[model samples]
Target: MSIINPALERPELIAYFLGANNYSWLHFRNGEKKLLSKPISYLEGRLPGFIRVHKTALINPDYVQSLHRPLRQKMAGKIQLQSGETFPVSRRRWNQVAQSLGEHLSPGNNEEPLQESVYLDDARPTSEQSNLGRSVASLFLVTSDEQNAFLARQVITKNWPDYRVETIPKSIHLPELLDDLAQSELPVLVFLDARSDTLERLQTLQRLKNDPRLCRVPVVLLALPTDKSVIEGYERQANSVITMKEGDMAFAQVIDRICQFWLKIAELPAHC
Candidate 1:
């Protein structure tokens, strides 16, 4: 698709895209611009892989420096730009975006060469699998620190032996991550840490839940204190919220619940 240049008619107009709502702004070189008032839905279909990471900017994955995963739902990783600007990657879109990055780096894509270690496990399963079921499931774990990320991976691998678990660093670019998620298959589950800020995280969750493409993907927020009021608020957008301090058995139980929930959704008879 061709890039939309509203400046064609108004030669002085500059174009800026925002992903928060998927709207673009047409600005004149003279510093005046009007919000296009178009729904992000339209742009989501036409824009290339990279998109607006926030309400005020568009990002290309090629330019991303790193992705940081925050430990709490409210605070996800900030996308570091080549220009030194930081953008937020909503917990909801983290997995999708990480998958997209892997694809981009895969052979035949424009991504740079992979390190030897990444190639060492080429034969490994890309998605998780199990004798318990036939379908493969993708899990995205959002953590605040490397230790948690490692722990989460260990838990997932031990319990859901057959599923593919993609652990995204919170420092990556949000737009790039979402682009990846957009291309993945159904039955994706995202685990968000609850220790982070809730307002921004909720906004991100709301956006992901609202997207028809990603709406079905379940989002489970991980809360430590396990406040009832907080849980209720997140439940509006999250599939479920489980406390990490609840011990290994409880953690496993929560994972099982999520697995069951997603499996049920995946098994629904298709209309198509």
Candidate 2:
């Protein structure tokens, strides 16, 4: 029973042993416990903002104390935890992990200062982009897996380029994240990954959709390959449903389409 302290910037979460895989077992944590019979890969896109620090650990950057790039050749850098547990950071994800932590520490520093541009693309109007410059869109993604959240961030960085992206794993409670989202003035987009069969996922979605306070903010359901058939059910409640294979282009297209729709509605003539 490892307990996370409150002084640490990371959220307090618990991990339940889901089952055993070849290398690692599945885990889910909130205030209480729930185990899964599935593999960790099945929860990849489902956990928001979490990253696989080691074969057995999915950690939220908030709880990370520091990154240790050891001089030893065989060992990669490790992410030190407040609990004193060091999770190995793979060579492939070193840069990405560092960048994500850097961005979190220094917000609004990555993008070029918003400047006036006369040039316009055929797909969107100059005024549209200009307006977008004036307003910021912060997409807060919630998934059950860190890798998938990073994937979403990569797609967003490649396509939107102008917006900011942050991810949190499902290990943190949905209510807590929603509270933070409500505090932010920017347009908040919540991407929920369909991973766990736990009632929390469905219950949270239902509550958010029905809550008048949160219903207007866009919520996207990221469906797994196996969950394709259930997407239609979510569409009625979610602003959009995105399948895993659709990739970045398709995901960006969906974001652009929704933004355009919102802009049109906002700019509508009073008489109409």
Candidate 3:
């Protein structure tokens, strides 16, 4: 991973990745995709279970949904992801890729109608124009669950009128963002849903705790009172653990107290 100021080397900073054209890899950090100076072959060797779907693309199998074999076998197939993003599978490597994937994955039975093209609007970043992801994420909520994201933003914005919330993908997890905030002399409060955060988030949280660069950042895990992983969360060194109780009133109270304590009462670290 390329750090703007080269003192830190954080490979764990990226969320997911794929090769981009300019001898660089599209590193999705904190769900916002950015280009990094890393070769596709290098990533393929480094990441276990990462499948070479295309000559240019090496996909992490944990994120793979299906590699759809096309009706017209002359053209290449497409590899769809759980995030509803799809990339073309190279025709030359199709057989080898299929063999590696095994049965029950390919020749998708629930053939969803394909869009105009395999390329998505979101993928065109870096290759096309300049993006302001960090500015947009200034007051963002990183989560995979649409309902939780909506509800959290609703509560946060209604109470804090000056803040505009951006609901971001939880896949973008790690230190580059924290590094940016730290450099800017700014403090960011992150709220992770213990049950609802993505499968990748557990690993993300572990790395967050271990990385000294992010030790000062505040991370709050909103979990149910009965959650077994609540113990593991504290072990992971989360700054605050908010127990979500039952009932709407209880939920509202928890949110209120969380905002009150973090925003009003507690003395946060001096980022500036």
lDDT (0 to 1) per candidate: 0.49, 0.47, 0.53
Which residue runs does candidate 1 get wrong by more than 4 Å?
1-18, 22-136, 169-184, 224-235, 244-272
User: Of 2 and 3, which scores higher on TM-score?
Assistant: 3
Q: Against the correct fold, how does model 3 do in TM-score?
A: 0.48
Where does model 3 exceed 4 Å of error? 1-41, 44-140, 162-164, 171-182, 185-187, 197-199, 245-253
lDDT of 3 by residue, 1-272 (tens): 34322311344444346554445454443465656566667666666566776556666665667766643322345667767766665556666666666643556532433222211112112211222332211233455556556566667656754434444455332343343333333235666666565345555566667767666667777666765667767878877777664333444345556767877788767554
TM-scores, in order shown? 0.48, 0.40, 0.48
Question: lDDT by residue for model 1 over 1-272, one digit each (tens)?
Answer: 22354433333233334533445654333446566655545544455565444434544565555544443222244455444545655445555555555543434332332211100011223233333345444566655445555555666676677665555444123223543332433336776655554444555566667777666667777666657636654666777666666343455456566666765555432312
Predicted model with the maximum lDDT: 3
Summing lDDT over every window of 10 consecutive residues in candidate 1, give the lowest-scoring window.
113-122
Per-residue lDDT for 1-272 in model 2, tens only?
13222212233453322223522343223334334444545443345566654344566665566664432222235555555544445544555656666644434322221111110011221223444535445555665555555555666666565665555454223442343232343245666665453345556677677766666666667665556436643744876665554333355455455545544454422211
TM-score of 1: 0.48
